[model samples]
Target: MKRILKRRVLIPVFIIVFGLIQFKTIDKVNMVVPAEFGILTIETPPKEVGELISAACFDCHSNTTKYPWYSNIAPVSWWMKKHVEKGREKLNFSKWSDYSEEKRDSLRLKSAELIEKKWMPIISYKIIHPEAQLDEDQRELLISWMKK
Candidate 1:
């Protein structure tokens, strides 16, 4: 009787708490990306290379993030927002044209090193986004472009 009573009380409490938390939501707005500021518009890489970057890098590193369905949830939304903010702070590809030539060169070299070591498109991201999972050939192509 005591165990039955505990489950009855706990389940309702848990559901109520979960429902209440949903009130806190992350902003899902994707600001319009101007052609002048976009990396693809400025750099003009080959189609394959551009596609790879879009799949693996753009969501977090660019201003226009394509938020996933889970991002609508409370705790997950909060975490994803923080992750994207951190990524953009490191490098905002949407502001590529704003960077100086020297800075761009330095960023390219660093990007190559990070990709070569499989440190980018982080494991957690790749797990959910299979399209962002770059095979060896795809990784090589991206790394070569960044090295250039």
Candidate 2:
């Protein structure tokens, strides 16, 4: 009788835990404004530079994020939120106009330096996002764009 009761409780508990693990929630927020509305424009950046930056950094640094299916999971979503928030705070490309000219130049140089050092996409980020692993050619292109 005790063994049967134990099995009943354990089965229900396991099911509940599994169900909780499957539950997902998503909350997205827009964080960009027009460059004209602020103090900058994308007119200076080359098309390739813009494309590379978008593909590699826009998810965390822009108003819109292309959330992954895994991002729907609970713990992963929570972590992603934290990472995105911090990344945006550090350097929001979408809000480039809001920064002072000095800040803008400093950020541009930092962006170039980070890329040349193979540190922009970050190793941990590339581990999960293989497409972000830029080749030597891509790196050179970014470096050249930055120098301009």
Instruction: Assess each prediction's global lDDT (C-alpha) against the native.
Output: 0.91, 0.76
Instruction: Please state every model's RMSD to the true fold in angstroms.
Output: 1.6, 4.0
Please, what are the lDDT tens digits per residue for candidate 2 over residues 14-123?
87886787665657667547655321255456677677777888777776677888787777887887778888899888777778878877887888899999988877
What is the number of backbone collisions in each predicted candidate, taken in the order shown? Answer: 0, 0
TM-scores of all models? Answer: 0.92, 0.76
Which window of ten consecutive residues has the lowest lDDT sum in model 1? 27-36
Q: Evaluate model 2: give its lDDT.
A: 0.76
Candidate with top TM-score is 1
Per-residue C-alpha lDDT of model 1 across residues 38-88, encoded as one tens digit per residue:
789999999999999999999999987999899998889999999899998
Candidate 1 TM-score versus the reference = 0.92
For model 2, the stretches where C-alpha displacement exceeds 4 angstroms are 1-26, 35-40
